[model samples]
Target: MAGLITILIDGITYASWLFIVALGLTLVFGVLKILNIAHGSFYALGAYAAASFVGWAASMKWAPGLSLVAMLLAAVAVAALVAPLTERGLLRFFYGRDEVLLVLVTYAMFLIMEDVTKLVWGANPYYVSEPYSLFGNVDVGKQSYVGYDFALVGLAAVVGSAVWWGLNRTRIGKIVTVVIHSSEIAASMGINVSRVYMGAFAVGIFLAAIGGAFTAPMISVQPGVSVGVIIVSFAVVIIGGLGSIEGAAVGALIVGLARSIAVHTAPVAELFSIYIVMAIVLMFRPEGLFQRIQARKI
Candidate 1:
């Protein structure tokens, strides 16, 4: 039983990581309908940037706990600057176009950004140990693991709740939510959807950055690390229902736990576990597990 509990914890932590990376992707896709390949670039950039910042802090003898703030700041800084620029300068031209073209363009942008990473950071693996040391470890039954991993689960839950509240409670989040459901209606009502879209993209990018930053200290930060998660994350987003924040959280936990089981019982099944669920879900319930309910407007 202890072994099972340990595996479950491992799965949840992995799921949290998946949710953190995927939530932003779903938000952008929900709002823009672009299916951005550049989303992966942000993830990669975030990881690299976080690794760099944390490494610098450690070398300077700063507290490892402070690296968390630095990681978030780096992500926010990158998103604050890059989001508007990308939305206006490049992505704007492709608005309301074919999905395939938008995809090609974003992939081109992703390629360019990937090269930029190489140019800026070089092609080497960077790791941040501050986060690991800060939380230290815990003995879950017999196995010892990083407490930061559990902390990440809590953080992802908070982020998920905050995003849900943002969408339902805040004016800005409402506008963005409107944009997600119907941009035409939003614009017809003089909502200034263009700005909203930019802001949404910025938030999406910021989340991606934060995911990278958070994971950097726990995992190896390399140029291609973003590529590693992009596919699996898409699966999580799809399984959780597209453009659904709650769905993303739920989906991550599912995939994380499933993969954990596979890791222990059937190693070969780990890679395909998510896809199996994706196929099953898409085949039956196209809208996903949680369908929005709206009352009649009499």
Candidate 2:
């Protein structure tokens, strides 16, 4: 029973972070139809930004609780500054091109952003652990978990619910959906498809940054963090089916639990567990668990 409870708590915490990152990947793919390889770079940048901001806040003698706010603001700043620049400055030009070519473009962007990060932040690791203990701890069964962990679970739920509602229940969501179904038709119908693309891309970048910011306290913020997240997020998005919010949520849970189980039972299989699950899911359902077969128009 103790083991089971531990697994559940750890899995849910892991899933929360994965969902946040994968949600962005799915959102970008859903609306923009762009498989952004540089999304991971945005994540890394967010972590670095949060670490810097939170460190500054600490040095300024601000309240420790406000560090969370600083982290959120870091994500917003990244979304506001980087997303538009990337979209308008580069991705906009690549629109209507071959999908494969667009992907390569993003991969190139990822490489450039990596070097940019190194030039700016150098190679030193940043440890922003102040916020991790702000909320204190909670005792669940025999396991005492940090309150921040549970807070993250709540944050994930709120973010997921809000995105789902915005996409399904709001008017702007309807417009975005129309754009997603067929941007050409949307533009013909007098919709500013370019603006919609920019908005959606910004939102996607925001989510990625939020994931990285929130995760910064738990890990050392440094180079190479982006690579792991992009890989895992891709797995989650692929397993959930590209462009599917619910699929991203479900896929995160599945991968999280699978990894937790592997860690507790067979430590040797920890890294391979997620890929094995992805392979199995792909073998049975090529389009992913949530995405339907999109018909190719001749």
Candidate 3:
């Protein structure tokens, strides 16, 4: 029972990380109707930025727990700088184009960003563990673990709830939902689709970046980390029903728990476990479990 509880807590932490990355991807797709492959790049950039800033902050004479704050700011700054330029300058050109074309553009952007990162930060991996270390430790049974890990679970819950409230219970969220349903209609109703697109894209990037920043304390900031994050984030988005926030949350939980279980029950199939569940879900509900919007006959 104790082991199971530990596993569950671990799963929650993993899910939170997944949510941080996937939420942005889901929102970009939900609002802009485009799958930004650059989502992963944004996350990578955030991690890199956070790592750099936190490292600098640590070397300086600063207060305790400041590095984590630096991490958050670094992520937001990166998103603020990158998201607007990418969305308005690059992604805007392909707004009304085919989905594949937009994805291709974002993929190309991701490639360019990869090279750019190499130029800026070199090829060496970087890391910062202040956030984890600051949270100290907690004792459970005969085990002692970082308190930050458990705190991260609570933080993830707060973020998820806040995002849900922002999307469902707020005026801007309602607007965003309407735009997602039909951008054309939303525009016709006097909404500025361009502004909406930029805002949504920025917010998405913001979430992804923050996720990276959060993980900077634990995960190594490697050049290719973005690649895995992109893949896993895509799976989370698809499993969660493309544009559904609730689906994203549930999907993260499902994938995280499955991965946790696989580690103990079937290590050989750990990688395939998620895809198997996704395939099963897709087979029964092609449009997704929570998707209520129906397609019309063309």
Q: Which candidate number has the best TM-score?
A: 2
Clashing pairs in 2: none
List, in order, the clash count of every candidate structure.
0, 0, 0
Error of 3 at 5 (Å): 1.7
Candidates, ranked, lDDT: 2, 3, 1
Clashes of 3: 0
TM-score ranking of the models: 2, 3, 1
Off by over 4 Å in 2: none
Give the deviation of candidate 1 from the true structure as CA RMSD: 2.9
Better of 2 and 3 by lDDT: 2
RMSD of each: 2.9, 0.9, 1.5
**lDDT values for all models:** 0.84, 0.94, 0.85
Clashing pairs in 1: none
Which pairs of residues clash in candidate 3, taking residues 3 or more apart in a chain or in different chains?
none
Give lDDT tens digits, candidate 3, residues 184-291: 899999998889899998889988998888888889898888998898888787787888888888889988888888877788988798888888888987776666
Off by over 4 Å in 1: 291-298
